[model samples]
Target: MSQHLLHTPLYDLHVNMGAKMVPFAGYEMPVQYALGVKKEHLHCRDAAGLFDVSHMGQLRLRGENAAKMLEMLVPVDVIDLPVGKQRYAFFTNEVGGIEDDLMVTNFGDHLFIVVNAACKTEDIAHLQAHLLADVELEVIEDRALLALQGPKAVEVLATLNPQVREMVFMDAARIELLGQECYVSRSGYTGEDGFEISVPNSHAVALATALIEDDNVEWIGLGARDSLRLECGLCLYGHDLDKTTTPVEASLLWGISKVRRTGGDRAGGFIGADVILTQMETKAVDRKRVGLMGQTKAPVREGSPLFDANNHQVGIVTSGTFGPSITMPVAMAYITTSCSQLDTVLFAEVRGKRLPMTVTKMPFVAQRYFRGE
Candidate 1:
């Protein structure tokens, strides 16, 4: 165990449950509990799986010019975000490269932002440097987050709080769960319909205990979490996205509002607008992140070289694993724009052997988002 690693509020509980502890993003987290990855993955797909995501950073921003200040850093239309709604967004540098991806939720008076753990400190520093003096930025370190994911997640969650059933995807609300005020959102990294609950740190253990007491819920670990998100085609920060990859090349243009894309009132004001706009007009991105499927059981790992039909080094695998839902090896890689088409044949250099692969559509598994009508 690394002494420098931080522990989540439920670290002791994970140890008590015989979780396989490992180091991830400077945290002492459980990669997989006793249930193992395969069982946990299946359980999440069929029933419900409880995940401890408290390592993520939670922050609050508020001021008279809060929305305006945030819009300067990101390309999203922050001013148009309605209260109780959440929008997926990215922080880009001046050159159109991604600084980090995050979720910004409008809370009527303030903006509640959830950022990646590894980039939290840097993200805060960047925001503070750019934000005007009137804008107030508060880091809420006294919170813990949990994710309940799967088809039966809503049913299990309704047992504790019935109001959450009315929340639609990307919608967040403050609800009372087990006598504690919690922020429950109908959103998750996995493709399954799930909810992420943010609770007071003091009540985290109690809430987790209550959820685990239910027979339908199982404690899932990071091992299965990675595979689940991979099957969903969701990008993992630092791996699939980084300071070098732009949102357009990552296929995340949907995050940028149409108003921002077109030269509307809010256009050309955010960071990297010139480069992003140029890319949009020319459609001249060099490489693209795509999904790959192999015919055999061989698994492709990160850093594997990708080759084109002419035996040229086109790209490299960023993330790869055997998806339990798809029952085969799945991978994500950055390939040349010309070879990024679906069903494009390619080869992955695994162990000095050329393994045949085909470019497949992303989200190997279908998404089940709950958009309440």
Candidate 2:
């Protein structure tokens, strides 16, 4: 491990809990606890798992026109993000490639944004250089984030603060926990009922301890985090998404609000909007992102090449792993339009052998998000 690797606020707590730490996104993060990745993955599926996601970047954009200013950078309905609601969006480049994917929440007074950990430095610089001068882009360095996810997450969180039980998926709120004010959102990367709490760094360890003490909750790490999200069919920034992949190519067109597309009121106003909107209207891309599953037990990994029966290269795997919950090898890849269709047969070249695979619908495991009634 590098001596200069950054540590999250809960680093010491992870160490104390017997976590195996590794370098991830420049931070020395826990890859798994004593229970291991497979167990941790199953635990989160059956009960609850707590993760220290403080390494992710949290930022605040404050100003009267903050939403309007942000509209210039990404293609989402930011201005119409009702207060206390959140939206998923992409930060696109001039050529329509994804710069980074993020979550934006309208806080009534300001826009609270969360970007990927590895892209935070560049994302901050991009925002500062592009946003209007009056729209102050503040890097929130004093906060720590924790994700409590699973079928039992609501029950565990409600015990600490009953108000949280009322928040549905994508709902954001300011809540009190152990007398500390924190921003709580009923949202997470894993396709499960959960909450991502942004709390002050000073109170992070205490909050983690309070949650982990619960019988239904256990310490989860990055290894399980990857498998869980992969099973849920979520993209990892540098892998499934990158500067060369456009939202349309990545199958994230649904993220582009109808009002921001070519014909709507706020259409084509954001960076790369012209290219992205054109792609959306015409479906111009040759390749599309799709889900894959191995027909056999052998696991296919990232960077593996995909080929047709005649041995012609057709695609490349972006993210791949054995899904503990699905009990199968699941992967995400970008393939030619012809091979991207569901149930299309393909072969993954692994270690000199071509293994049979099939294009399948994502979320190999069922999603269990808790959207309120």
Candidate 3:
């Protein structure tokens, strides 16, 4: 392990709980606890699992033109985003490729952004270079982000502060929980219902301890986090999504609001608008992202090539894992558009053998978001 690896606010708590620490994105993060990856993944599905996501970049963009300035970088309708609602967006390059994906929440006074850990440094610099001098960008360094996810997530969290019970999926708000004023969102990468809380660093350990003390909650780690997100068909940065892949090619066109597209009110102002919008109109992309499942128990992994019936390489796997929740080996890949259709048969080259894989609909399981009644 690198000696200069960074530690999260709950590092000592993870270590004392017998978590196996590993290096990721320059941080010594817990890969798994004594519960192991498979059990931890299942525990989250059945009960609740807490994650230390402090390594991710959290920033505040404050100014009257903040959202308008942010729209110049992402191909989403930022300016019109209603206050207290959160939206998913991705940064695009000049060539219509993804730079990084992020979440933007309209806080009335400012926009709160959360970016991927590995891309934070570059994302910060990108924002600094392009955003206006008046749009204040503040990197929040004194807070820790924690995600509490599962079927019982609401039940457990509501006990701490019943006000949270009113928040539905994608709702963002600032509330006082356990004596700490925290920024919280009823959202998570997992397909289950959950909440991501950003609390002051000084109170992080205390907050985590309070959550983990419940019999319904346990400490989860990165190893299980990957499997959980993969099973839900969520893309991981630098893997399923990258600078080489555009939102259209990655099946993320839905992320672009209709009003931002060619015929709508705020059309073609973002970076890569020409190419991405053309792709949207023509649908002539050579390759596309799709879901696949193996015929046997053998696990197919990333970088494995996919072949058609004629043995011609059509695509490559980007993210693969055995889904403990689904009890099957599933993966996502970039296959030729013609071969990316649902129910299309393909093969993944694992080791020296070509194993059969079928193109199936993503999110092998149902996404259970807690949308309020």
Local distance difference test scores for all models: 0.91, 0.93, 0.94
Per-residue lDDT of model 3, residues 161-196, tens digit only: 998899999999998888999999999988999999
Report residue 83 deviation for candidate 1 (angstroms). Answer: 0.5
The residue pairs found clashing in candidate 1 are: none
TM-scores vs. true structure, each candidate? 0.98, 0.99, 0.99
Residues 1-373, candidate 2: write the lDDT tens digits. Answer: 8999999999999999999999999999999999999999999999999999999999999998899988888999998899999889889999999999999998888899999999999999999997786789899999999999999999999999999988998999999998999999999988999999999999999999999999999999999999999999899999999999999999998889888987767887998988898898899899999999999999999999999888899999999998888788999999998888899989999999999999999878888888867
Q: Kindly give the number of clashing pairs for every candidate.
A: 0, 0, 0
For candidate 1, the per-residue lDDT at 18 reads: 99
Which window of 10 residues has the lowest lDDT sum in candidate 2?
Answer: 259-268
The local lDDT score (0 to 100) that residue 368 gets in candidate 1 is 87
Q: Which regions of candidate 2 deviate over 4 angstroms?
A: none
lDDT of 1 by residue, 311-331 (tens): 999999999999888899999
For candidate 1, the 10 contiguous residues with the lowest summed lDDT are 259-268
In candidate 2 the C-alpha lDDT for residue 101 amounts to: 94
